[model samples]
Target: MARGAIPPLPVWAGEALDLITDMPSAEDLVTAMATQAEGALIRAGRR
Candidate 1:
């Protein structure tokens, strides 16, 4: 391999990257889940 050439990724690493690309931002996901949890709790009279 030439100097500074990128090495091949293992199969799992490539799959993990693909999954990560499809995910929403962490902040957005957390906010969405937290909102859902709050709504559920409100429906159950807990919050």
Candidate 2:
């Protein structure tokens, strides 16, 4: 693949991707999940 290009997803993964009709793109979902995980960790550290 060219620089910065994402490699092709596997067949099962491609099918799973199609099921996500209303969700944000995978990259956006990953970022949002990372943010939430970080917030949870910070909160736990304060306990």
Candidate 3:
């Protein structure tokens, strides 16, 4: 991969890449994932 270039990805992987690119920042992604995990854990009664 070159600087600032997105390497080709498989269809499923590309979809995830799209979502990542749409995020405003890496911190936002981490926070969102953490919140989701917490929600899932709560729902599963593991939290």
Candidate 4:
């Protein structure tokens, strides 16, 4: 941070900054979630 109030940063936060600043890919998200099906464990914890 410019203010010096905060210690610089951890390695993972720097890496996450790059990832969060970039645009997310919808198709990639869908592909990644393909294994999860509708009505499958949607609310298992509450049940």
Q: Pick the candidate with the highest TM-score.
A: 1
lDDT of residue 20 for candidate 4: 79
Give the C-alpha miss distance for residue 12 in model 2, angstroms.
21
The order of the candidates by lDDT, greatest first, is 1, 3, 2, 4
lDDT of each: 0.92, 0.82, 0.87, 0.67
**What TM-score should be assigned to candidate 3?**
0.51
- Candidate 1 vs candidate 3: the TM-score winner is 1
Task: After superposing candidate 2 on the true structure, give the runs of residues whose Cα lies further than 4 Å from its correct spot.
Answer: 1-22
Candidate 2 residues 1-47, lDDT tens each? 58977767796588787888767888998999999999998999952
Model 2 scores a TM of: 0.48
* Model 4, residue pairs in steric clash: none
The parts of candidate 1 lying over 4 Å away from their true place are: 1-18
Tens digit per residue, CA lDDT, model 1, 1-47:
68977767786699899999999999999999999999999999999
Residue range 1-47, candidate 3, lDDT tens digits: 57977667586698999997887897887999999999999999999
Candidate 1 vs candidate 4, TM-score winner: 1
Selected candidate, larger lDDT, 2 vs 3? 3
Worst 10 residues of 4 by lDDT: 38-47
How many clashing pairs in candidate 3?
0
TM-score of each: 0.54, 0.48, 0.51, 0.29
TM-score-based ranking: 1, 3, 2, 4
Between candidates 1 and 3, name the one with more favorable lDDT: 1
